[model samples]
Target: MEATETVLCSLLAVDLTDYCYRVCSRCQRVLPSDNNGLASSSFCNFCKSKEPKLLYRILMSIATDTSVKTVICFDRAATVLFGCSADEFFHFTKLNPLAASMVNQVFDGEMLRMTLTRPHNRNAQHMRVTSIVPLRSGFQPAIVTLTHICTKNASLGNCSTTNHTLRKGRAVVLDDPNEETQTALVADPNQEKSQKKGMILPFKPLTMTFHNVNYYVDMPKEMRSQGVPETRLQLLSNVSGVFSPGVLTALVGSSGAGKTTLMDVLAGRKTGGYTEGDIRISGHPNEQTFARISGYVEQNDIHSPQVTVEESLWFSASLCLPKEISKEQKKVGMDEFYLIWLRYG
Candidate 1:
């Protein structure tokens, strides 16, 4: 029989505390560890293997904005989010203490969208975190206002000028509580008329480009002390690529071929790596805005085991779709179209 499932969307109100786990050296099954956080130096009866390897097991307590908190016991979600197995995470932390510290900073004050499962005959629950999206506390209103103005200005044809003027007017109204904001948003009809009369071009497709990219990370002191000339290890060298709109690209390579390193560099996700090169979108350098507009999925199965298929669709639609769309329209699009197709198609 299948297990029951539950889905939770909440702020990670506390830190993700990690514990040491022991696994059989050969078979890789979890084993009991001693107080030193090391597994017994004896043979493992489960796999008849000798010795045990230490791994990192992550756990966290999460709460909604209302302060309803629950302690989540992690299974695969931690592995997916960390981009490595527990054993690999432990080893990586050991080798790169700086990188480990940088990673720890990602947890506090992030929004967690996770899925949980409950077995039929047991009280224990399991969880998988599908996403960890960082929320900048005070930036939403400004971002929404800018996006509205940009959309109005970029749309082609007869309505563009009127729409832009109206949006600017609305901005002035909404921003009236702040005197400086009101002054900044006051529309200029003269400028709008001049811009409209000159030229109006259709929206252009965005193309992301990276040229002659190189990335390196600091090497461990032990390696440098052992007479290694370079204190920094180069992960990628002279990589060049272009990703045009509507084109599908794949980065494929064997283990340690720097595929992930190159991707991380282009996505602006690498914090501990030393990078040098041009990464641009539509002739502009990539920035935090790139991260806001692009989505990257890690190679892990992350979904709420308890959420119904329809509930999952609703969850995404409500959070991801444009707020300008009416609630009725959004529901119709989901229930009448996307949900139906997903069920029968």
Candidate 2:
């Protein structure tokens, strides 16, 4: 039977073998690998792109008290458990054989609230884990815990396969035989500090003004039959407002007030209503660009239930940020917003 469920369960075991798969960055389809386990082509057959980047698709078999389920955790949920992206996790495991075992130890018997979905197809084997939240407070991700263990073992002369060093707040992996070193910086603490210092993304701020705004909808048949002679019912009349940048504006009104109607007209969000008004942005008449610059939040908003907050921010940054900004800058901007949200929200 197809079903979706939320359960409070403890992780009994986790299988780390074959934990990740490679997919085309453009189309997100599985890419075939060669004999050396490298992507066969730089071009994606599905998207027809010449320079196709690769991303990691993380999968795991997790056992709970009820049953053992193989689930596709995807990127966001997997990142929460690993404290790093799937690509970084794969690289760490390749450099050190004990990394996977250490991760298992870190996650074993952890309490979690999981949203699981079963496919409608009876032949499908794996259930999809839409979301994962650690039930315990002060939860540490696997990578951080493993890094600590590895560092401790190295200092005590117990680690033999690889050497660990901390350089510039990053974990550096040194191969013993050739003395070759690979450094992976999970996150920059200094950058986070700077974000906490109130760094904001650059944008051209504008002021919005609406004068003598009016909104109306067609009078219902029942209302017309009740001896109402008007052809249209007015929801808002003579609503005037000026909203400036960097200012918090409140629309204080009780039930049946025209606050929502005025906002809908100003934001060009009223779908079936007729609006008559002079709505200007920065003293200019409202244009198509107004929709791009302004946003309206409805009383009730809908979002994908499966997406985590981090994932939502990433998606919004990738899609809504200016195209001129580089990807790295966009990432930094997204992080700054995330920090602000956590602090105030």
Candidate 3:
């Protein structure tokens, strides 16, 4: 007999989850070999014996296909990406809104694409994520390729993570999607919009401000503390923008014009520690209060070897999202179509 790889959609869970549904009328009653096989099962001797293995297989398949980075059993994963680590991040953060959303689609026959900025340790940093839901449920990824969208090196990693220089073609890794989620998967009507185009951000501002920002060109403390003058810290520059939300704003200039400094300031990097100006987020331009909603993607990222495009997006989605959203809502949000353009920090 030929090796059997059950077409996932054609199979239904023996469990009483929504993953099992009636077959289309055109199909036969006994689990159709194609699109019409969802049904509840009353296990006999064979079913009872095979249940464990079958469920395991399904879960493994889900894990393999989910393709996200930094699967958080808790909120620690979120902190790791934000430079806040577990203890601090968990205290005051919500679930990563974007990653949580894509998890459903990945199981609902959606394939995602991820563009990571400043990738390292196979993590997607400052990422642009999108998804493509298949017309039929439980299909393979429609389009998959992970790229980059960034301005430049945005921040410094902790000592443990910095010594390692990033090499190209490293594979990103993440926890497998849960069986429970896959069992309850549902396709989104808006998936078409997200899949055909670029990534979606739940809340991004139109005009951003940078005030009292400072910058300097010096090697990290470890490398330059000796003999290197601390005074090399020059006031790189100060800048502010009236960038319209959902529109691209480009900062173009020569090598030494402080473009990196400007991108960092707008992103709330080292500069966030110093400045005060109102960044108008959507219509809620409190400048002072709502600025944390911004995203800062760098030029490189942590992409694992053999990680599919969709997996990369999932990783970014998880890290970028806010905690307030529910799992189902996240699925719908990430499924919408978008347009992504690259930035140079």
Model 2 pairs whose backbones collide: none
Distance (Å) between predicted and true CA of 243, model 3? 1.4
Candidate 1's displacement at residue 65, Å, is 46
Between candidates 2 and 3, the one scoring higher on TM-score is: 2
Candidate 1 residue pairs in backbone clash: 5-306, 6-306
lDDT of 2 by residue, 1-345 (tens): 568988654453345544454667766655666988777877667887665555555666443433444576666777887777767776777665555555554454466788988778754467767689987665756666566545544654543333333233322222232234322222345744654555344344455666678899999999999999999999998777666444576889765797777877787777897888777664457876678876777876456879997787777677666789998998888789878988999
lDDT of 2 at 213: 82
Candidate RMSDs in Å, in order, are 29.9, 24.2, 27.8
lDDT of each: 0.53, 0.63, 0.32
lDDT, ranked from best to worst: 2, 1, 3
Deviation in Å, model 1, residue 247 alpha carbon: 1.2
Model 3 scores worst on lDDT over the 10 consecutive residues at 142-151
The Cα error of candidate 3 at residue 206, in Å, is 4.0
- Which is the leading candidate under lDDT? 2
Q: Model 2 Cα displacement at 80 (Å)?
A: 0.4
Q: What is the lDDT of residue 197 in candidate 1?
A: 53
Give candidate 1's root-mean-square deviation (CA, Å).
29.9
